[model samples]
Target: MKPSLHAKIHLWIMALIILVGLGLIAQGGYMQAKAHFAQFLIERAFEQTLVDNQPHKPWSWADTHPVAKMRLLQHNAQGGQQPLGQDLYVLAGASGRNLAFGPSLMLAGAGVGEQGNMIIAGHRDSHFMRLQYVNVGDMIELYSATGQLQVYQITATQVVHETATEVLDQTESSKLTLITCYPFDQLAGNAEYRYIVEATPLV
Candidate 1:
């Protein structure tokens, strides 16, 4: 049977909408898969850095190299750290480009494993997603390229306004400050607040 002109137009519009919806889904899937695998390459690069004692780029043409490795931990009965197995590769610089691949060390702050505050920043959705789960008494570890381990205990956490640059200030004692966009579950990347995790080295 021949369809009416109005019915043919309706069918065409519906087909176009379906195609657009499918395309969106496919793109989203691709991104999720990409993020899942990209971290493996960064992890591998970190291993080479440890062995070579030099900066090893996760991939050719990347401006950043793995500078340190971080792991979450819990305190055991003996007050020793029990690894949570949440390893993250810390990149050389905290620029937006570098943060896309992994949490990065802010160049303006103290060097990793140094005696001053070291600020690391990552996207709330990806590398820093687990940061939201950290507690005040939990332990965190950062291992340098030479395999030197620095242990710290989480001291505090707060949500600060986006303009609160004071959080990046240097501290009298060694500290680890992790920053991520606030409201972790929000779909917007440019939130007006930040989630800060402050940790002090364990004696």
Candidate 2:
């Protein structure tokens, strides 16, 4: 049977709409799955495992403890080549973005209770967008299989140059330094400045 040109055009439009609908569905599904996987990883990293009323071995960064992976909290500035699911130490701020040179190895360092500063870097985008939201007295917590470590408010924010080593200076107190891209508006490439958020142990 010969169909009119209008019928053929309508059929093509219907097919195009169907394909677009399918694409949207697939994209939604993928995003949902990724979110679920990220949550799972965070939970697993924070999971509690006990041994003889103490704690399991794999939870800490001592004696071959498995590295705890981190996930960006969406809107994170640091873009990763891998999706949020792959088990890698997710950078939370500039350090996470500058994985090669910055504090990407923080997880492998002293877990939480050691002396000296514990610096962590993540992108301004996804990981530490909350930096601006952080108030002077707010509390930040880091979790691992062993237990959760709480850090109290110290300095909520600062700005430094990319060439400034003072931001990474050694501190007597157990500190956590989070770095991220600065000026927030420059999205083309790496910026010349950085934003730092430093916190101290509660006690």
Candidate 3:
């Protein structure tokens, strides 16, 4: 039987919808692959930076370079802590582009291993997700470009409004302030509040 014009139009629309859906799925897969590849390159650059004792850009056009190495440790039953996972290479800037790659050091605060509060910001969904399990007494180790390691013990975890800039304030003491969006499990990003992890150097 010959198909009516209306039936043919519906068929075309359905075919078009399927094509669009497939395209979207393919694009998403491509994006994920690209992100993983980029991360691999960034890690390699960090290794080079450590060996050469210099900044190494992850990519040719990248504006940021690996500035430091960071690790988060979890408290064990014996009153000791063990490494949670792999060490994260800290980037130089806190710009969105840099944060997409890894935790970024905010230039507004003191430099790594320097006096005053050294602020580091990262996306909750990515590198800093482990910060959720971090509690007071857990330890954080930050290595400067010179491969100098500074150990800090977690002191406090606070939730503050995004407008609160006091966390970024310069202090007479050496402090490490880690910042991420609040509500770790929430799907909606750019939350009104921020999850802050404050740590002090271990003498």
* C-alpha local distance difference test of each model: 0.89, 0.53, 0.90
lDDT of 3 by residue, 1-203 (tens): 99999999999999999999999999999988987888788888888877988888999999998888899999999988899878888888899989988899999999987899999999888888889999899999998887889999999999999999899999999999999998889849659989999999998
Residue 203 miss distance in model 3 (angstroms)? 2.4
Give lDDT tens digits, candidate 1, residues 101-135.
88999989999878888999999888898888878
Task: Give the poorly placed runs of model 2, Cα more than 4 Å off.
Answer: 1-25, 48-110
Sort the predicted structures by TM-score, highest score first: 1, 3, 2
lDDT-superior candidate, 2 or 3: 3
lDDT of 3: 0.90
Q: Candidate 3 clashing pairs?
A: none
- Root-mean-square deviation of Cα positions for candidate 3 versus the true structure, in angstroms: 2.1
**Following a full C-alpha superposition, what root-mean-square deviation does model 1 have from the true structure?**
2.5
TM-score of each: 0.90, 0.57, 0.88
Top lDDT prediction, candidate number: 3
Comparing 2 and 3 by TM-score, which wins?
Answer: 3
* Each prediction's RMSD to truth: 2.5, 9.4, 2.1
Residue-wise C-alpha lDDT for candidate 2, range 1-203, written one tens digit per residue: 99999999999999999999999999989977865564454334334331222332322442322223432222234542222222334322323323431124355334444677766665565445556555454455554334444544545677889999777776776776777778675655768888887777676
